[model samples]
Target: MELKKVIILGTTQFSVMMCSILESEGYSVYAYSTYKEYLNSNFFMGCPVFLTEDLVELMGGVENFMILNTIGYSKLNTIRERTFADLKMREYDIMTFISQKANIYTDKIGQGCIVMPGCFIGNNIVLGESNVIYTNTVLTHDISIGAYNFIGANVVIGGNVTMDTNNFVGMNSVIKNRVSVGSYSIIGCGSNVIASIKSYSVYTGNPAVHKKNILDINSVNI
Candidate 1:
């Protein structure tokens, strides 16, 4: 299905990247920022930007409009979670984007996801909502990724791996087959995951090991 008018929910650099991809898909892209000062930006990659606070009064209706969240996964993705929840409360149809260059073998993609260019998603993969899979990543068969996960660029995941909610897997990481990463975990960049990871933890190194229990992970300086 093709969408016409789309609104993005952040003014980040990644937001500009999302805007470029959407414009390639023939979307009339608009941006809404939670920060009031950013509203003064006349253009974000050629699209008009606005403040989310002013959206309801100025725009007559949004019946035909859909919103794409551009919030990144930092500080355990609390900002992204909040933005998503607020948009859902307003009952907006959240838009998902898969690059034309992506080779998606299955149709199990969820709403509000962003799959960047050169990604190879193999068969029977159940990708959850609001997950960001960046460029050149490789996901093999039967992998299940839970919601709100940020998988960074050039990562490789083997078959039958299961990932739980709210995880930020850093760039160039490698996950072996049948491995499961629990909820609210962070996989540091370039690490190799051979075994299952527990919830509320941080793992790094060649063979990924538990560094800390991060239930309050955000408090530890990122």
Candidate 2:
């Protein structure tokens, strides 16, 4: 594989972690942040940090760069999704960051995925675009998750589950097998998903009942 230089989007803690991982793996990486302060800073963590607007000028071309949207689940999947779309529109390819420590037996990990360390992705799993499988999570076999979903750290997802687009599963949550999570749903942290969820809903608590529909809800920090 050609070693495309890594460009991490956003200046959050997640960006720091990804930059560290990519560098440790001996990849050339820079960071891009939308923060106004980062414009004058020039470099971050010994690598250059660019104003997101200047992306076209710095790289000169997209073929040599691989972009990773480390902004994470803002408004669930909104920020990450928007960043991915913006970069894609600019003809820049999104990079999938798989930790060297994770055990991925599956052949089909989608584009722009960030699979963190100590995670286990079992056989016949189909992960969709720009999903974030955080550290120490276990995705059981035959699970199919759709685009722009964020599976938090320490999550346990059982087999034969089918999730639709734009779901956010919070940390330490346990999703039982064969349950379907509908599109644009948010499963709160430390919750359990025992049954299938409806579209545009927010689920929480131990049994993880539907708290409310996302349409009625405006915005929340994940």
Tell me the TM-score of model 1: 0.89
In model 1, the worst 10-residue window by lDDT is 30-39
Cα-based RMSD of the predictions, in order?
A: 2.3, 2.3
lDDT by residue for model 1 (1-222), tens? 765578888878888878888778687775555547456685665667767756555465667677788898877776777778777776766788888889999899988888998999999999988899999999999999988899999999999999988888989999999999998888999999999999889999999999988957567444
Expressed as tens digits, the lDDT of each residue in 167-218 for candidate 2 is 8888999999988888888899999889999998889998999898876333
In candidate 1, stretches whose alpha carbon ends up further than 4 angstroms from where it belongs are 1-3, 35-47, 53-57, 220-222
At residue 99, candidate 1 shows an lDDT of: 87
lDDT of 1: 0.84
